[model samples]
Target: MKKLVLFVTMFIMVLPVRADEGMWFLMFIERLNHRDMQKMGLQLTAEEIYSINNHSLKDAIVQFDGGCTAEIVSKDGLVLTNHHCGYDAIAELSTPEANYLKNGFWAASRKDELKPKSLYVRFFVRMDDVSKRILSKVNDKMTEAEREKAINEEIALIEKENNEGGKYTVSVRSFFQGNEYYYFVYQDYTDVRLVGTPPESIGKFGGDTDNWEWPRHTGDFSMFRVYADKDGNPAEYSPENVPLKPKHYLPVSLNGVQENDFAMILGYPGRTNRWMPSGGIEQNVKYAYPAWVESSKLGMDKMKVHMDKNDKVRLDYASQYAGVANYWKNRQGMIDALTKHKTAATKAKAEAEFNKWANKPGNKEKYGNVIATLNNYYSKTNEKARHDNYLVGLLRTSAFAALPYSMGRGLDAYASADDAARQQILPQLQAAIDEYYGNLYEPLEKDVLAAQLKLYATKSTGYKIAPYVAKIGAEYNNDFKAFVDKAFETSIFTTKERLGEFILHPSLEVLKADPLYLLSNDLIAQYRAKSDEQAELDAEFSRAFRLLVQGMREANPDAKYYPDANSTLRLTYGKVRSLPKDKRNDAKVNYYTTMKGEVAKYKPNDEEFDLPKKLLEMYEKKDFGRYADKDGYMPVNFLTDNDITGGNSGSPVLNGKGELIGIAFDGNIEAMAGDVIFDKDLQRTINVDIRYVLWIIDKFSGAKHIVDEMTIVK
Candidate 1:
């Protein structure tokens, strides 16, 4: 009975489709609680969000990769998103001394706020179901690669035909790997400006320690205003730039969430693991997260030791430390929660149960290695993820906006680079660096890469980049004496000088230089060159992944297959629920955390639990403004069964009425398996309600001009 219950629960956690006729009857029942998602929010008509045949969002949400989801909030060209999302823009315009990320940023007055050099948000001008357009070019007789090539050729011809001399980002999205396709034309404007953001202590709040876990109170958002050319066309920033009047905007809500209300998050969620095979789930439990969790823990321990014994290295990798440390602590809870739960063993049993019902004679070959194949893919995915993090996060993820910084880095390395040009890019890079790195790039690179490499080593046997990384890692980890000695050749430092002198300057031009800093840049440049090759590799990976998907389909033709996520609009509905994490209910508390629980758990000096003084004051005063939910004390944590990934951050979480209820942020601990498999019980998304955002803006930043643009609802 115990094993049966566990199996049932685990199967429900990962199932994506809600259907009664599926091979696994239990997967369908698990989705019953989340039926609200099938219909989306009650407030929204189906036509308002997705084009029924198109599987895309209606022209309301404009997305930018600048860590934000923007909406044309007012007809007067005003845009609204989380405040932290706009921090990079503000930082870009700030100076080293200006330190925008530390102080929180505000436009003060419109003329005073700095404009990002090349910031922009994209709205979908049109999206066509180009599936037929390309598929027709190939037939069943063609090989998989041949099919893709034919599709690519057709797509290019169609794009050239349909574009009619207009500019937009054209992308072809594939479903079920190569099963289906679609194309979109995006109107990308290059001019965007920083409008406002709360202080880091307010916006970041709990910071790294609290990331990904609930009872969460971080505002974790940013704000920016988009602009248009004089001709009402999207253009670069200019003195004459005017605010872009948007065609549509999401309305704010006064009626906030209470217990068990249905909610849905809508945005390009970055990634999720709703489709891992049972074996993949087992491997993650047995291998992936545990390995990563341990590495992160050890890396952070080393970081702490460095911080305690050496100030300069600590300061340098502050962001890196925060990031790795945050994930380390955060993931451990998830790993613990996942391992304690019966998800893996139960999933394997469920697969076996499904096999009993669906299996025919000689079926093993059809479903052969289904689990093992998924596990293999899971092991290799991190290599691509690490390579991407190195580029997008540290190097050029924010390229359009961070171009100046990237260019400046190039210029700095080559000293003869023009100052006038460098001057143009430097101010932007300087502030962005200050805001992002806090001038801590050198040490941060060492820390971030060190932790990442450790994980890479565990996941892939012959990881393509291992040879390159091993060479660097060995030298870096050898010891303080050897690492420092070999860090730079013809160096100037002696055993006598301070760490800062060695890092901040070459001791007398050659006294001390570090290989890590120079190598970090080299890796960045090296990877940028390899990125295209990676894309080709990814295309191959996708081919292999799709073959597995096809194998799964052939094994269970009736089993529904969802398309790979392409940062396009998608709607995944499930019930608001909690998972049972303990093996046998030792505590009797089905695990989930909330605001009251969060407040009670708060520990003053603990880095993760340290609340901002201002927030604490608000709580003390019972200053429940319109922002407070019926439960009181800003409903800081809420959950939903929205299938989301990274791009989903800042997504507008809506209730049955389509009213903005929460801003999607992190996934619950049970869901960390989400990067591999979303357990229905554990797969809830953590969101900060919209009311808190309004309250924070109205109360914290006091930005009335920005507030007035919204169509507030009660």
Candidate 2:
């Protein structure tokens, strides 16, 4: 352990600490980061935070639904996560008569707790450094493909040997752009159930307008309970299963946050590319994000028109709309923030410095041409990148093309099945088709498909189009609506009834002959052709990227280097603070927001700011209960400098004493560039104060039963 610490510390000894940057590996924290954290008021030791030999903080954290972080808060395995993390589950449970999304839901008792069809939480078992094992099987002389195959083989062997007969999910992930590797083992619990949630008016307060902005008052949290078998082991969901007895759970702290207080967050951060070259950043900003933003906006606009008018439609498409809107806003922020911060120019300057170092003395052989190679690849594929984005957007978001492709494979399967097998699987296939059409709106989709097809046919970003494009031009005179009208008239995928009629007497030839299916097949073929053309360039870029990351570290051995996040459990510590307010904005930035601010933003019947009448009465009465701070106001949300990204949503924000004070939810808009390059002065993590969460659960919702389950520290 000492030796490992020394090796990590040696690399970062001379590095300047810029706003306490780094998403550090837990295993190395005791030796490499404990002292710095302690100086910032950390009261827990590294082992106490992440010991494998004993139950520690690690046992409390979980990978929620394979995408977000969640933590156990009670002895009975009560899990806490972002409201958006549980959005799909809540939407699934919703109905026109009882919309849990509009009005909040609180399971009055354990029996009332609802489990979604599929929801799971994974607990981290352990992680191991397997760099030497992976690197031993390959040499520098090996081609990139050969090296990848050899490494994968080695990783499979390691995972197989350590799986303990499949009791845990084991896999290896590359870190620092494949300069290092680590193996992780996790045990998943599949019986997670929803316990409580506030309404969208609170949970999704401010909506898209306040999503990534500060002064946030959104009570963005939801609750769940993890269940286990009779013996307290992980098991499938069953009525007989009982709430799990967790190994450890966080003690919630009611102590309010102050300016510059110590803060820490631990979670599975999805991904970041702090080591990306300037050329890649430019390509994303200039080519990729614009198409993504435009397509997502168009999809959201169509969904909103239907959702606003019909309650059933709103419930059916709520989760999907939120997902699209989140990224639509995020991509815009990324483009604006990156360009505003001059990230590409900064990266270019640094790349030049690294290149200078690489060309000096003995470094040339190992690192030569890495920068130029990466730049050339990005430049050569710039137009193709935009074309691919536009194509993917049309196929994925444009349901006319998307549904056929998604359901076509299943149709083909049914066509090839024997009579006995077909009878057995027919019901399942019918159910799937029913589910797809249940949420689909043909009128809206037809318009969307027509618009996207017109764009695809007219766009000059790419060199080739799907084969069906020629037919649209030659036969329909480039009239996308005319082409769509004929396809919908003939394709079984246009309506659920048509699909059902075709399924009654399935034919492989007829299915293949359908215009929509042919279009789907043609789109796939075009995608494959483009992929094949770029295959070699992609490989070259990958090799160059690996070398670039390694060369940067070698060139600046004395600078601190933390591996980019790859959805692995990590700890990032810092302090509570606010960024300097932009001159263009009139509102003064505050470190924390309160219930007063939430009320101030309220609109009586507005979709984004509507407040429940009961809550409005409570607010008018100033009935904050016992959760109000010393100043006699209920806290809503706060800001922290703790380094975090997308997957860190719902991660516990801990005080120096290792007590949960808040839940990390979003990042500030000005620092959207942080994922590409950490901005010391701008980046800030937005968190929902735990006090606000508890207040909503206890006072507003009247679910004191939940308050009784937690270990509260006043």
Q: How close is every model to the real structure, measured as TM-score?
A: 0.71, 0.95
- Best candidate per TM-score, number? 2
- Candidate 1 matches the true fold with a TM-score of 0.71
Distance from true position, residue 51, model 2, in Å? 1.1
State the RMSD for candidate 1.
8.2
- The runs of at least 3 residues in candidate 2 whose Cα sits more than 4 Å from the true structure, single-residue gaps closed, are 1-16, 424-428, 528-533, 581-589
Give the worst 10-residue stretch by lDDT in candidate 2: 7-16
Error of 2 at 22 (Å): 1.2
How much RMSD separates candidate 2 from the native structure? 3.8
What would the per-residue lDDT of candidate 2 be over residues 1-714, giving only the tens digit for each residue? 964544444333223366378898899898778998999989998988999999989999999999899999999999999999999999989898989988979999999999998899999989999998888888888888899999999999989988899888997999978889999999999999999999989999999999999778899999999999989989999999999999999999998899899999999999988878889899989988887787778777867887888898788778878988898899899999999988888778767766766677798887878888899999898877777777777776676676787788888989899989888878888888877888777777777777777776666346567778767766887898898888889998988888888888899998999988888777777777846548788888888899887876775566656788899999999999876654423224478887878888889999888888888899889899889988888789989998899899999999998899999999989889878877778789999999999999999999999988999998
Write one digit per residue (lDDT tens) for candidate 1, span 146-165: 87788888878767765658
Q: What is the C-alpha lDDT of each candidate?
A: 0.55, 0.86
